[model samples]
Target: MKKRVKWTLLSLFIIVVIIRIILAFLTPGFTYESYFHLRQVDHITKTGFLNYNDDLSYGGRTLIFLPFFHYFMAFFSLFLPLTIVAKILPNILMASITLTTYHISHSITNDENSSLLSAFIVGFLPILFSTNSFTVETLFLPITFFIIYVFMNIKRNTNNSFGKSNSLWLTIKRKKYLYLYIISFLILSLTSTLTFLLIIGFGIYMLLSLMENKKINKEELEIIIFSLFFFLWVQFIFYKNSLLQEGFSFFWQNVPSGIITEYFPKVSIIEALVLVSTIPFLTGIFVAYRSLFKLKNKKSFLLISFVISTTLLAWLRLIRFKQSLAFFGIILGILFAPFYLEMEKYFQKTKLFKFKEFILPITIILLLLSTTIPAINASLKQDTPTEEEIGAFKWLNENTPTDSKILGTLEEGHLITYYSKRKNIMDDQFRLIDDVDKRLKDINSLFTTHFQTQVLSLSEDYNLKYLVLTPSAKKKYNITEFNYLSKQCFGLIYDKETKIYEVKCELK
Candidate 1:
């Protein structure tokens, strides 16, 4: 039975990797914030690790952005080309997540087939599939599950060793487990700010355990102290990197605010059902709550922790729309394992037309299809910059100075920085810089104002060196060859068939 489970899990992982490769091929360019990360990886390859002074964005400013994911990619880029590494790394990390999901679910339910089913569910979750490209969230998924799995093992050991006299000598002997937990915590903390949410979940579990026992266990205290220490350390690094002048104000001013209603805004009720697979999630929650009071069922505590932590972060707007949904999907898979077993038993007892023989297989196939089809279709339709726009960026790379700062739409800022290796005043990564509103207003005025003086003033204020007008920008600003600025401004350096232009004239 164990061998069969292993084989089944291996097969699911292969399927996930294959799908990710197919998506990577179908969608050629990076998506969204991936360009920023690609640039960071390039930086790491040139310089050593942990160099936070990114000269590409915000006109030669420093950022305290997380570097672990980029560092990981850089290590791989040592031997292979970065393009190849980027294409396959996310899929590899995602496969690891599938394996970790299976182990976590099996630890909770001790059922092989059900655990494999859980792995299958997570492997094909629509949100996971959608974000499985080169992104930090993809890396976060497996680390989050691995941390929970380690925590569960620690709790099980402590529970089994209850009243066994945990002396200092015993603590000394068990230092390895403590080291493992601390290492995992550091990885999660250094990888992203999202680790704070995981720390909150661990705190809740510790609080619940204390309420029941009236005292903290040795393992629990160690975890709490280690987590608190690292949390403070991460915050300190952020402050120090921000030069302590901005302090926490940097984060407060930069991170955008949004309401919880924005979570999964594009997902219809049907898609939500398909993403979460309503029956298993509902059944898992029911079973977990019913088993909440059982002494041996400590696994239920972690399940509850997942639900509370993810929901709280979603409500607080700490995570993005798809990210919140993806985390919930993992929780659903864990809970669904036990629910599947219960249903299997029911089918066997009632002899319900041999339901047990086909039910699990049919459900897995349907769930996989629901997510896989949508993800592939979405990948095929994913939008990227036009060839002309890319050509304009390439021309800038060859013609402009390395440190030149350009003022353009936020949509093009990332591409400008990544492809041209030049500085952009702002980009879609608004959370990483300060004065987003003011910078956006400046860009808006530079494009929309009909007066050449205002345009020159805005350019002078931003220390602008060049202007790139893509087709979208031209259409939006209604710019033509005979525009007023064209008569007053300098000559165009590069013009593409797609009507994209790179102007070499000064504003003032």
Candidate 2:
């Protein structure tokens, strides 16, 4: 039975990898945001350092971020092409969440089949279906869950050791997990600011224990305290300049107030249910409500704490939309184990007990179908650059002068820098830019307004030399053609599905 479970888990991991690799090949290049990380990896590979002072992004601005994920990609790029490393490595790291989910579910349910089902649910989770997103969260999610698994084992070992004869061996095992948890957490902290979600979840867990008149584990309390201080110190070291410069507003990452709503939009219940799948969303919520309110199921409180933390932070608009949803989906996936086990146990007492064998397969099939469609759809629908767009950028790289600056929408900013090898007036990295809000307004006016004089004045102010007008930009500004654009001022340079215009008329 154990060997069967092991092989099944291995097969599940491989299946996920194969699916994602196939989906990645459906696009010519990665999503727009991936080019930024690609550029960072390229720099790290060439210069052996991160380009913190990026000259091309936002037209020469200092970027503040954690560098561990970039270094991670750079390490693999030492042997292979950076593009291959980007497409394959992220999917593999993301798929490893299956292993972590399996262990977490097994620990809670003590049933291998139920745990396998949990792994399958997470492997195809719709919110995690971005096969082309080369972001820190790919590495961050699996590491965070591995830390949670290690932490869970530590608590379980401590509980099981009470009055046991092999106490010394148990003590050694607990120490091993303790070291593993700390190491995994350090990696997570260096990877992204999302580490705060775990730290905050720990706080909520302790508070829930106290409110319930339950004693918190001594080791858990000590480790939570250590994590809190260690996380603060590490963040201070990396973001000291921004922390002192922006003060309390640093929590917002200095995002322009005008567009903060877009970054952290409120996720509706229906939207979240569709992303996480209807069964797991409903089952997990049921399990959480039962655990907290009636059954007082302390065993599931740790997972429930995360659900609460993610919900609270998301509600407060502290976490970004997609990230919050992804984390929520993972926690709910792990929680499904307990709910499935309970259902299995309860069914054995009813007349449906005769049909128990059929139930498991049917439920698994339902989950498989529910999540698979959304996963494939999400991967196919990724906002990657088309072949025509790449051709335009390559032409600009070959034909344009070295000092040319390209104007694109916020989404196309990184693509302009990476493919065209030219300076971009703005990109999504909003940290430490004093004029971010003004830049956003100006970009909007340049694309949407009908005033030619305003466009020329703004163009000269930023030293804009070329402008890209793609179908996306047309849809964004709700204009089929720029009425103010004429041959005297905006000379069309490269024309295709994606067009580029050279800025000709100078402001007098």
Best by TM-score: 2
Runs in model 1 deviating more than 4 A are 161-177, 210-216, 240-253, 256-297, 348-353, 381-388, 401-403, 428-434, 447-453, 471-494, 502-508
Off by over 4 Å in 2: 162-165
- Residue-level lDDT of model 1, residues 1-508, one tens digit each, is 4777778788889888888777876665767467778878878898876556667777866666777889988999999988788888887787678898888888888888888888877777656665325778768878878877777766666655534476554565456555777787888887877777677777777776666664557867778778888877886776564535545544443443331243324434465565566665566567767656554255677677667777776665566656767777778777878878777888878959566678977877866665567656655555556666777787888988786887667767888888887889887655446577678777877777777667667667777778777776777668754243573364566666433333335643
For model 2 the TM-score comes to 0.98
| Alpha-carbon RMSD, candidate 1 | 4.2
Error of 2 at 280 (Å): 0.9
Question: What is the Cα-based lDDT of residue 203 in candidate 1?
Answer: 78
lDDT of 2 at 184: 87
TM-score attained by model 1: 0.85
